[model samples]
Each structure stands twice: as structure tokens, then as C-alpha cells.
Target: MGDENVDEIIKDFILLQDDIVIDRYSNGGANGELYFGERKLLSDRVALKFYYYNKDVSTHNEPLILKSIEHPNILKIYDAKIIHQQYAYFLTPEISGGDLKNFKDNNIVSFYDAINITQGILNGLSELHKNPNNLLHRDLKPKNILIDQETKTPYIADFGSVKFISNAENSVVASKSTQIYRPNESVVQNVYNRQSDIYQVGIIFFQLLGGKFPEAPFEWLDDRQKSKFLKISGSEFEKWQFIDSAIDNLIVKNKLLDYDSLPAYINNKVKAVIKTATNKDLNKRYFTCSEFIKDLFDLKKQNKDWRIDNQEIYANKENKKYYRISEDKKGYCLQVSKNQVNWTKDNKHDGTLESIISRIHKD
Candidate 1:
């Protein structure tokens, strides 16, 4: 639950949570924090985000991410509002227990953990990439990667990570690359291409293998082939060889050598998959999240983690849930949850794609 002024007959939108135990999890983002409640929400015991902003506006891209995505791997956005003049980014199945960074820091992950994240993140991004609308997640980091304790699955958190490409424009370029993202040649060229997302995935995969990067963190190049290996800062580069050797044994050579420091079961095949995925060359990498998923499949098949016994029976359809939100006559909206929709909550122009999608989610 939240301190919402909920005497609403004006909007069809449904709020995801009520006022109960909304507390900050992490000093989320630079200013935001992940909030969890004592009791489950109206839909399910969910997590909510009170995104901070520059001037009394919430900057978290929760609405953008929700607008374009709906998947098991993504933290579901349920509602977004300007309550008490501060932005509250509402989401369903509120994620707790921190992010992937904690898991990586504690080295609490196994091959199963890595594989599930690989699959979930890729599946979520693949859906976003394939979405007819061009939406890019510019910021993908361990901190933004959440895992629900109940399902124990990874959910890509925060929409402040979003970038949208415009079709009407002759030229459009996204903002500067973050320290965490590894830019491909095209992205480095400031081309605002789809490959930027691919580059982000590569960085995440690398972090998955070697933990965190230090100093300058990820490497960015105008060309991956031209730049095979560039100098990086901090203990990250120092540990590169150890990671290199670890990946080499697991991947390229297919040697099932177990690390004295690691569990017995984590061996060659898993390493190889992670290596190829985190490869420096963006072109040499899988272009979309769907293709990247193949690496996990290969790892699972070779290592036997994913199987009929482990996966759900493939059904032709997924359950459909819809909601509504009130926006300015012309603004965007995303279906955050079954009962709530984060309508670009702006009643600006007479219309926005989010408004259109709002209609669809309702239908």
C-alpha cells in the first residue's frame, strides 16, 4: 500500500499496491531506492519503485520499459503516478533480496543461476527488440537486475534504462554510453543502432563471469575486430586472465576442468557458453536477445541443465491481462499490470502510441 489519493472515478487505471510497508531496499539508482511492502499487493505481493528525478519529476524509465515489454524475465510495471508531486513507479511482484550485483559479489550463483539469468534477460530483451516499436534499454547493470525470492528468477529492473528510436526522423542518436555498457563499433559511432543493446548484453555476460569490473569498467570501441583487447582499469584487468583461463577451459577447448575454488559440477561447457556470449567483438556476437539465448541452450544441452524435466510444457498461449490509465489527450502509456496501466500519464498532445496501446491493453 502507499499514500495514494485514491478517491478516483476519473481514471480507469488500477493502482497495484496500497499503503502498508513501503520501504526503501537500496538507494536505488543514483537517487532512487527499491521499495518493498510488508504485505503482498492487490495483484500479488509486489515491489514498487519511487523513482527520483531532477525537478520533482520521476526519471525512472519504469513507464517506458512497461510500455514495450511484458515477460516473465522483466519486472512488471503496474502503475506510475505523481503522488505528493513525486513520481512513484509501481510494479507487480516487487523484487526483494537486492540485485544481481549482490549475488555476484557474494559469488552466490551457480551454473543454474547464470543460465536462468542468461535466458530471462535475453528473452526479455529479445521481446523488446522484436517489438514493432523501437525501444532500447541503454542502462543494463547488475544493480538493475532483480531476482524474486519466491520464483528465484531474475527480472530486469527499471525503465530509466530505456531509449526509443523515432521512425519519423531522418537521423536520431541516443545519449552518451554509460560506464557499465560495452559499446559496439556502431554504438561508439553514435549511430543509435539496435546493436547498442547487444553490446550491453555482452557487458552483463562478462560481469557474470568475472564478477564486477573496476575503474573504467567496460570497454568501448569503434570496432570490435580492430580492438581485440584494450587496456582496462582496476583489478578487473588483473583478473582477466583468470577469467580468460576459466572461460577457455569451459568454452573454446571444451576441457571440463573444475576450478579448485568452484563447485565440482561447474565445468567446461558452461564456461564456453558464457565466454562466447561475453565476447568482445559485437559483430561476432549474437545480434538480438533471441540469438543470445542459443548460448544458454548450448550450455544446457551440453551440460544438461535445461531439459523437459526442468522446463514447462510449451503452451501455445499466455494469459492475457489488461488495464487502463488517464493521460493527457496525447501521451504514451504502458500496461504495467493486470489492473493498472502507466499511461504516459501526460495529457499533452491529443495522442501517443502509449494511448493507443492503452486501448489495446483494455481490449
Candidate 2:
């Protein structure tokens, strides 16, 4: 739709309600538009989500789900209304800090800050998982995580792909938006349960820590290709082009570094937690979000000073200050303004620092 049409719609929406439209936010997927507005009576700023009448089940159920969920880490729904059965609108507290993706891109979040943000996300997820509604946030990515500008707290938002599994007949509903975060079991066996969300949480945890998505050397294909492969059953997967060879390559490459190759900042115990959370085997993964949070807290307690001062430079690309830690004749030294970090004794570079920063700027 054109800008004028959208503005007219917003104006009309404002007239119909007791809220004043401050400005219109970006358009969302699935025919949704976000707006910043204030309630006339209370003058409270809120984020308004507007959706034109659509047949999508989630579009109709999102407000209901948000209303049922009551947690500090979860986004709050102030009110919802359908106007003339043509538009559906809902209000939430306006978060000025933007989403996690924007925060990760703009600021150099310290390890402690990363932990706090991640913990907030986990806290929210735990609440959702434990809710009697049996909610599953099928779309759990950085973009869906909103940050509070004042407190720098994280809030899980966007229930467009939420699924309820309370009923015995509940089945998985596939979506292209969340293909990258899908667990191995969901892809291969067409099985999705609470464990699947845990796996995605693990991915988000890795991203928060490393500033990039975990990419095993074996994943030669891009996300699109992988999504296509995921649609095929495991029994027939081998028939695809060089599937066996790819799996063999992954196994061989994984043995080289394993999870132990993570940076010195991430100790063995932390690595163990991440490994278990993202384990391909559902039987081995954390059965509940609370279990994952406990292990994360244990790791946090062990490290008195979680902040790594040197790591901060890597995140601030605008400063143009890049450094590589290396050992010279005297002792270990840091080389500044370098394209890449020097390979360690094991011939492994810090992929998180070198690759993630570059990728973020490119994006």
C-alpha cells in the first residue's frame, strides 16, 4: 500500500479509538503494521499493531495469547479491538530501544549485559512454557525480542507463530519465517515439541554470546537450502545430492574443535550448557527452560568478572578499532586495526569476533 493510504488508515483508526497516533512504525510481515500511539485518557505511550482482516489463524489469536500471558519479560497487551470487522488492532507498551537485532548491531554489549539480556529472554520463555495455555513461541528470533530503552531489559514479543499444545490433537504448523531456528527433530522427523523451542533458545544464546549464529563447518548450504532439505523426511534425505557426504564432513569437522574450541571467555561449564541446549538429540537436550536457566546462572556465578574489555572493541565497528591478540618476542601483544585476528596455536581464529562483526555491518 502507498504511504498516503497507510496514513489515512491510521488517521481513521485514531478517530475510531481514544488513542492519538504519534507515528506509524514499519510494516510487518503477514499484513500487519505497527504504530506508536498514546491513550487519550491516560496519555500512556503504546505500540499499536494493526492487521487487515485476514484468514491467518495467528492474526486472530495473537491478542488472545498476549492477554493470557502475564510476565514482566513478556510484552503486555493493554487492549484489543476489531473495527467494523475490517481491521484488528492491539496496544502494547511502546519500547523505544528497538529489537534485539538493532541493539546487537548498534551497541557493544558487554558479556554481563549479554547475560542479563539473555536471562531476561529465558525468564520470559520459561513463563510461556509453564503457562496453562501451553504456548510455544514458534517464532523466537532476535527481531522478535524487544528491548526497553530505560532499563535495557529484554521482552519477548510477536506471537504471530505461537502454537498451543495443551490439546492432544495439537499439531505443528509450518512457517517459512522460522525455518532457520527449527530443531533437527522438527526438520527430520516432523516432530516439534517444547524441546524445539529450547533448541531455538540455545541458538539465540549462542548469538548473544558470540554476536553471530553458530555455523558448523558442515553446513555448506545457506538457510534457504537447509529449509528445503528440512522439508524432506530423514529416510529420503540420503537420496538428495551428496547428503551422506555432507553429514560425513560435518562429523569429521566437529571432532576438530568441538564445543571446547569456544573462546577463553566461555569456560568449559558454559560450553557444556550450550552443547546440551543445542544438542541434535532431543533426549539429551534440556527438557525445560528452567533447567537451562539454572545452568546459565551457575555459569554466571562462577565468573566474578564476566566482562571482557578487549571484546568491546570488536563490536564497535564505527570506531574502526580492530585488534588481534598475539604472542611476540616479549609476550602476548595486541595488533590494532587488523582485517582479521591471528590464528591461535590450534590454527583456529575467533570466528565470532572476526566474522560476526563483518556480517553485521554487511547486513
Candidate 3:
């Protein structure tokens, strides 16, 4: 649990491979500690996830599960082994773009890009659900996803809570970090199924569309309540109080999707997909990953220009630049920024949405 213990354990693993050089510690989450390192012999950068030996079956099964599945959107594991007799560590290629949480907070994800990212996640999830895998990614939050720097592809990472559908009835020890993402059935009955995975992915979809994280007794606060909620944040105790007050003010019951929080530009069809996927009733929800993907893919076919509403940031994955286009009473305004904060006016198009979009692409 201490830093020294981790160092001591990793020292043994490093000795085993003379070329392995531990660069630095990346981060520690509810799952485990991640270290960035490189193999001098192979000239490759890698990530090492260190999990202390525990009774939890998933901790031990993670590496094997990752090894069993092969997909562009899934994290690939090179090796899994017990180290210093106390830790179970797995090696994976280091992803430079970091996780979705950081990316979401920093950049404004475009409409089409959000759909593409969600599709990638669902594609990876499908692999886990297929024949031999039959696995449910119980904890599928933004933090568990890694984004590729070059391609902007989202890779599903963190398999600590992954389990097969056969073990759906088994009680899962939900960490504080994952508790917010738990589906209704998982919370009430200590169960998780294919639908549970669907529920979490739906939440991610909602988030990518500029909606706030829907917390339990999930309902969006009124305009006045939101104004107050924004102002009340300081100490940890105050934060808890804010959360409690927000929950108490919820007039609607069992609302999984916050339709109001979603951008107005989002059509009913896309909203319907999110609603069905995150539906509280297991019967109404998507039964499998393929079912979810079908709806999303259908939407993709129907719409080519999927851009979010005005004033929202859009990151062009091709050039790796931040840009946004907004239509005011006067005309359409396009702004570009290096960092998402300060913007410089790029162009103004008095024409239609298509014309502005054309300027955006050209700029």
C-alpha cells in the first residue's frame, strides 16, 4: 500500500528484464497503480498496472480477459505475471492521449466525434460479450477509457471489475469511484448483466453530448437550482451537502436520462437511442452490445454533419486544433483557439449552416 512496497515489488520485475526502465508513476485509481516505463531492448514505451494480490476474482482474471480479446478499441495486454509474490502486474502499450476524462474536461467533443468514440467503445464491448468472452465491463466510466493521440480512437481500459455473464448473480464490491455509474439492478440486487454494460455506455454517450454527469435519482436541476448549485462548492463537507440537496430536490423518480441537459441541436432520434440504452427497466433496455450499436450505426447512416450547438468547442482530430462555430442574431461566428480557454475570431459567414461548416473545414 505504501510507495516503498510498490518500489520494492517492481524492483524485482525490473531485475528480471535488464532492459526495462521505469520512467515514472502515472496515476493511481480505484483499480490500481499505473506506471509508465520503456523497454530499451525493444525501444517501446509501456504501461504497467500493479494490483496487490487480493481475494477479488476479477483482479486475477483481468490480464487473462484482456489477453483473450483482440480489438482496436480494447486495451491490449502483452504479459501478465505475479511480481515479488505480492503483486499482479500486466504490461500494455502506453497510450499518449490519456483517458477520456481528461480529454472531455480539456476539449469540447464534436457531435460526430462523440458518436464515433461511443461506437468504438460499443465495438470493443461487443467483443467482450461474444461467445467465449461473455464478459460484462461492470465499470465502464470515462476514466476507464484511453484515447489515442494520433487517431483519436478510444480504447476501453481497466478490467478490474470485468466478469462473465455466468457470474451475474455474484456480489460485486463496488468502489466509491464506480458507485455513481452502477445501474439500478446492480445497486438493488447485487447483479450485473449485458444490460448493465449498456446502461453505463449510455451515460458516457450523454456526457459526450455536453450533458452533465447524471447522478442517481437522475434528474437535471431547474435553471434556478443549477445557478445555486454552481455557486456552492468549497470544502468536502459542503460538496456532500450540495450533492444531498441536489438529490433531495429531485421531483422526478427513476429518470435515467437527463434529456434537458443534452444540447438542443441533438435530434430526437439520438435522444431515443440514449433513452433506450439507459432505461431503468431491464426489459426496455438494450439487451446486448450489438443491439446498441445497431441504433447508433443507423443514426450515422442518416446524418453526415453531426456538429454540436453554438459556442461549444470542437476539436478537429485531423489537425489537432480547437474550433467552434456559433450563429447569432447578426450572423454566424467561427472562433479558433489553441487551448480551449481563450479564442480568436477566425471567420464570419452570413450564409447557412452548410456554408459555415465549409468555412470551418477550410480554416
**Most accurate candidate by lDDT:** 3
Tell me the deviation in Å of residue 281 in model 3: 1.5
Worst 10 residues of 3 by lDDT: 247-256
- Candidate whose TM-score is highest: 3
Model 3 scores a TM of: 0.73
lDDT of 1 by residue, 115-161 (tens): 66767877777766664756666667777787765555777766664
Q: Go through the candidates in order and give each one's C-alpha lDDT.
A: 0.51, 0.65, 0.73
Write model 2 residue lDDT over 1-363, tens digit each, in one string: 223547466557665664464655566433477777676778778887887656554467888888988889999998887764567788889887888877876765655566678788888988887747677887788889999876879999988878777756444654435455666665565657787788777777766765334334226555765776777666654535444444434433332124534444565566778778878877789998888888877766554323334434322233344434444554434344434454222223344444433333332
Candidate 3 — number of clashing residue pairs? 0
Off by over 4 Å in 2: 1-11, 14-18, 28-31, 54-58, 167-176, 214-264, 304-363
Rank the candidate models, highest TM-score first. 3, 2, 1
* Candidate 1 ranges beyond 4 A from true positions: 1-18, 23-25, 30-33, 39-45, 52-61, 85-91, 166-177, 210-212, 215-282, 304-363
